[model samples]
Target: MLEPSIDALQEKINSKYTLVTLSAMRARQMSETKNPLVDHPFSHKYVGMALEEILAEKLTIADGQKKDSE
Candidate 1:
């Protein structure tokens, strides 16, 4: 079973598409930088670390309009 359940993650991210996008992007950043937001030992994968960061509310999505404007 996934440590941070999908349902819990969905609550943090409004849609499945957004969740996937955010996790993948964050995971890639982590992989490049070799950084883990959470001090978790369970996951050695960047995707897992990203999800854990999301669950812990350490990562958040900015409003789409704002992001697009930037």
Candidate 2:
């Protein structure tokens, strides 16, 4: 089972599949030259950034839980 936020993220992604295509185009453009939203491959960068942000947020949440436990 997916966590609620992760599920929400997936929904956001499913709803924005068109954006994903655009992002892929942007990524390809970046690979060929440059793009402001993403400096690296757009598709990979988009997913990577989303995952990274989620991980970081989860870490913060975990730290909060630890502090509360202490």
Candidate 3:
């Protein structure tokens, strides 16, 4: 079973698009830093690690902002 299941993840972020975007961004950072925010992560990959962080409530989206007119 996946450490951080999609169904569980959805509870953290309602939007799948936002979830994907947020995870990808965090994965990139983890790849660079090589640090695991959560202890004993089940997945070794950065993407999975990122998701775990979200599941554990270690990472979060503060707020959303609208783009201004050009």
Candidate 4:
């Protein structure tokens, strides 16, 4: 059985397949119903930043035509 924490994490990140998401997914998969895969050793330090980086790479927001000074 997987741990509650891992299950929660999987639910939190399974939808989007980004780095952070994938990390969580992997954790969930590794977890055994009620046991965390790795104690979430580095979850906080990287999850948000990793997700942001993945989104930045995938998204293509256009630059504003107007000058910042204007």
| lDDT for each residue of candidate 1 in 1-70, tens digit (9 for 90 to 100) | 9878899987877577777888999999988899788875378888888888989989878755233224
Tell me the TM-score of each prediction against the true structure. 0.82, 0.31, 0.83, 0.24
Order of candidate numbers by TM-score, starting with the best: 3, 1, 2, 4
lDDT of 4 by residue, 1-70 (tens): 5222444443433333333445455445434344332333333433432333223332212345332233
Off by over 4 Å in 2: 1-14, 38-70
lDDT of each: 0.81, 0.39, 0.83, 0.36
After superposing candidate 1 on the true structure, give the runs of residues whose Cα lies further than 4 Å from its correct spot: 64-70
lDDT of 2 by residue, 1-70 (tens): 4223455544333334533443455445555663334233223453444333333342122333223224
Ranking by lDDT: 3, 1, 2, 4
Best by lDDT: 3
- lDDT of model 3 at position 5: 84
